[model samples]
Target: MNREMLIKLWQAHKNDEWPHVETGQEGPLMTLDTVISGCVVYVLDGEEDLDEQRRAIVSDCLAELDTLEIEINDECRSYFGRLREIGTLLLITT
Candidate 1:
């Protein structure tokens, strides 16, 4: 919900990016695809039994990702579609 929580998650992902770096890369080498996908899954599954705070946090993450200029590839597009379907179902049921 807060900036601190979002920063924590981002930092975790940032740390996780190190091992995936290519041999000759200079900066962080992780794909936006992988990072965003992990974030999406974390928001969805991690917030499955959400409290108000968790829902707000997940919503904030989703909003932040929504604002970014991410180039979704075919695989990421498919995951997004699936996430939309799941989100729709949750909305309808709740």
Candidate 2:
């Protein structure tokens, strides 16, 4: 796992300065939280499905990292976007 980015996010979260945004069930019908978890974690899901609550936390955490200007590579970003798209589809589909 890309511990570097994850560490940055974890640090930002610990410092209470990540994403600088609030996460809740209330907001956009589809939120980052509503989707899957952190991109890295998502990619490394290893066939294990994550609980919604955990996924939400991870999603917002990633968003926080993005806001903090912590760069995630293109591959990860692409995978992230794909995961988001898949989530959006699922939301719309079901």
TM-scores, all models, native as reference:
0.35, 0.29
Residue-level lDDT tens digits of model 1 in 1-92:
33334444444444543332234331311243343445445654565444455445445544543543154444344444433333333323
For all predictions, the C-alpha RMSD in Å is 10.8, 11.2
Residues 1-94 of candidate 2: C-alpha lDDT, one tens digit per residue: 3344444443333344223222442243234533343433443345334456655655564555355323444434544344444443322322
Q: What lDDT score goes with residue 44 in model 2?
A: 39
The collision pairs in model 1 are none
lDDT of 2 at 73: 42
**CA shift at 2, candidate 1, in angstroms?**
27
Weakest lDDT window of 10 consecutive positions for candidate 1? 21-30
The true-versus-predicted C-alpha distance at residue 34 of model 1, in Å, is: 11
lDDT of model 2 at position 61: 49
Candidate 2: list runs displaced more than 4 Å. Answer: 1-70
